[model samples]
Target: MSIVTTAQAVPSRLFAIYAALFESETGEIKDRIEAWATPPSLSGRGADDDGESTTTLFNNTLQEARRIGLVEDIDDKLRLTADARGGGKKVRDSEVYFLDYMRRTLFDPARALETQQSGFMIALTWFLSSSPLRPMNFSEPPQVGMRAQIGDHAPKTELTSLNRYQNFLYWARYLGFATIVGGRDADDQNARRVIPDPVRAIEGALPAVFAEGNDLPIEQFLTRLSGIFPVFEKGSVREDYEAMLLIPVPDPGQRLSITTSIALQRLADRQRIALTSLADAPTRILDFGSREGRVSHVALRA
Candidate 1:
């Protein structure tokens, strides 16, 4: 089972464990983190550790970390990986950590191969490759009935239950590749659905994509974007992960996703960027059903 199967391995807790360890230059013994992070719900319940006689919440999560190579268990202590150690030394930003180190590890081709492709990676690729006409709402609720959807797209992609799909949602949302939208009632999650919205992530990455320049070609923008967020269309993550699926993921056309198109349009409207199509230039069209649009170049505006 991957980290998704381990309920205690949610992103917040995972980062908590990671941050605690990151703050420690030297490796920390297992007990220190266990005592601090074990919720009161499972504080003294060793038996609740899924049959591990010597385990608690932290122990179970630590095992999950070890399986994914996030943490090394050596001489009964936990140490963050070398790659995870670098960056924001004094600050240890969770967003940066998750987007960079955690994301890279979770979807790593070799590691994911051994784990049979984590639920998050599988579900994400399906959305990335889905046509704009298809439902991108891959949530955890059965009322929406996404299990059959996955079956239709990739019959071999086995999501054990709604719990696994929920785990996928947690990771997807935390990473900013997806967002929750449109709900009549807060209690009714089925009333709402997760959509492929990477606006926040794109906004955060604006500086990197634009760099010193004020504007760049649409194709260049996508190239830089796919490098940072490899799960997006034409990204390396999709290339690597799609091999595992029995059915080839459907082609959603070569244009940007409907969600991404909306994100760009939102940015354009807010004057964060300018989208234009030159009279004679290579152009990439935004996938908006409401109207036909083409963006050959983008200008980053202050």
Candidate 2:
């Protein structure tokens, strides 16, 4: 699928809906859902031309939350599940646990691959990892011939992926990973640009890919890591000051291979976890190849 159209095809309000529910008191699920569905002028853009009202957004969010095991529907009342509540833990513990829960619920690649918007999710991952340092400009229309490089590759212009780039800005802002500066512009009715908040992304969304038990396969681990950190490139290039947006081109096979290797090493360096090979094979580095390879399994050190 082409990147541009994919962004427009799926618009997510899951985060907003979740935030509303998270902040509310624990009883009266029906009332809470109804109040959330009410169209507060500031909460969301009005209903779409296709009968997609605020109520529809809330309903979709509820269904998604339930599907991801974040909430339970009991006797017409909605409540956060034990996992969502962080197993009744203390505040900080609960926050971390819930952040991880949010990641699994909304951004898991396995689940995303099963949907129509899989391309959009992949595109989102690409943008986050590839452009972690670059801020996006949303005020002006996307310019043609703006260049960026991922890893060792030469810089390439973003002429082809303009829509996809814009879509990323919209989606990231929607999920609170990025915020629009100066509100909506008067000319195009879009934000001038967006400032990405890595702290917010980590605290709110990145933790979900990690688990305390059971080793994750390299592919799954990389997918989770990709969402946590942007791929680092050596030697900075001149920034494209004129471009109003940026989107990552798909990584070349070699670049992706190198990225995985780097991510594994970083994880090891931080002493946050342990990596092991499949079938008790011994290796220093985690190998992506060999179904029975060393880097195939990852888990928290403890």
**Per-residue alpha-carbon lDDT of model 1 for 147-223, expressed as tens digits?**
44443544333445666666766777787767766656567555556666666777877898899687897888887
Error of 1 at 81 (Å): 1.9
- Per-candidate TM-scores read 0.77, 0.44
Colliding residue pairs in candidate 2: 100-208, 129-230, 138-192, 138-193, 139-192, 277-294, 286-295
For model 2, what is the error of residue 107's alpha carbon versus the real structure, in angstroms, after optimal superposition? 4.7
TM-score of 2: 0.44
Which residue pairs does candidate 1 place in steric collision?
Answer: none
For model 1, what is the C-alpha lDDT against the true structure? 0.67
Kindly provide the TM-score of model 1 when superposed on the true structure, using C-alpha atoms: 0.77
